[model samples]
Target chain A: GESVGLHLPTLSVQEGDNSIINCAYSNSASDYFIWYKQESGKGPQFIIDIRSNMDKRQGQRVTVLLNKTVKHLSLQIAATQPGDSAVYFCAENIKGNQGAQKLVFGQGTRLTINP
Target chain B: AAGVIQSPRHLIKEKRETATLKCYPIPRHDTVYWYQQGPGQDPQFLISFYEKMQSDKGSIPDRFSAQQFSDYHSELNMSSLELGDSALYFCASSPVLASTDTQYFGPGTRLTVL
Candidate 1:
């Protein structure tokens, strides 16, 4: 079975510094990608998403870059803050019949903001 | 500004007991998805429903079943629960008809099988 994975299990960054999290996926057929942030004891919150047609997308203070050739994805957060500390996951959207899409999440990376 | 809602913030059950979880999606969202997350693990897709019908299936076990209602809410039923079934269950929703719809997740229900 194809899987999505993160290169780093944990990441530490100083407050106000920029942070980057990387992910690798095995399925080339994946057409959409998303980044989610999960705080402790809560469900995942949608951060941003990009379709295969676009290589990069930007949200407020956050950017997601997708490299189709390498099957790689990365999330960059600017001005890291304590509230930004959480488990981040990258997900691939596998299209299904009738325009349905199923999300496959990768092993998450725990981001820590060092105040 | 409404978000997905789930019932029974927490549940405790013994082995072989049955458990039922409910989900209320955001208003006007027609598609619902269920996921399970073990400790320190990423969320795993279980199943999904679109317009009160099963839309997709994932690693859901035979002991579990789910359905979307006419009102667009969904429920997950687990029978003969085992200790390993303990985890955080999350429900998400999206409007499949939209071109750029994104799945928004609920706060989740914590199920503890004793």
Candidate 2:
């Protein structure tokens, strides 16, 4: 089965620096991607999303880049802050065997902000 | 803005026992999705409903069943639970169920099966 995965399991960034989280998908049929931030014991919070047709999309301080040729996706956070620490997951939208749309989430990258 | 609501933030169940999880979608939202995340694992899609109808199903065990009511609130019923069933179950809702619609998640219900 095609899966979504992360390139790293953990990441540490100094306060005020930038952080980048990477993810890859095995299914080329995936057409939509989203980044979510999960705090300890909390549900995932939507960060940003991009369609396969888009190469890049920008949010408040986040940017999502999509590379179709490599089946790679990245989320970049600018001026990282302490509150930015969390487990980040990248997900892809795919039609399941039953034709229902669902999200395939990555293994998750834990981001730590060092002050 | 109002977001998805899940009841009983924490639940403890014994093996072979049954558990029911409820989710209230954001007002006026018509689509609901359920996912399960084991410790240290990414969330796995369970099932979904659109307009009180089954829209999709994924990796859900036969012992598990779900339904979306007319109000768009949903419930997941798990029976004959095993110790391995302990995990965080999240419910997400979107105004619509589309390949590109953004789904907002609730606080999640943490189930601990002993």
Q: DockQ of every model listed?
A: 0.65, 0.70
lDDT digits (tens) for residues B57-102 of candidate 2: 8889999999999888999999999999999999999887677888
Q: Which 10 successive residues of model 1 chain A have the least lDDT summed?
A: A93-102
Query: For candidate 2, what is the DockQ-based docking class?
Result: medium
TM-score result, candidate 1:
0.97
Residue-level lDDT tens digits of model 2 in A31-84: 999999999999999999999999999999899999999999999999999999
**Candidate 1 lDDT over residue span A1-115, tens digit each:** 6699999999999999999999999999887789999999999999999998999999999999999999999999999989999999999887766667788899999999999
TM-score per candidate, chains pooled:
0.97, 0.97
Pick out the ten consecutive residues of candidate 2 chain A with the lowest summed lDDT.
A93-102
Candidate 1 ranges with C-alpha deviation above 4 Å: B97-100
Interface root-mean-square deviation, each candidate? 1.8, 1.7
Off by over 4 Å in 2: A97-99
Q: What is the CA-based DockQ of model 1?
A: 0.65
Number of backbone clashes in candidate 1: 0
Give the lDDT of residue A34 in candidate 1: 90
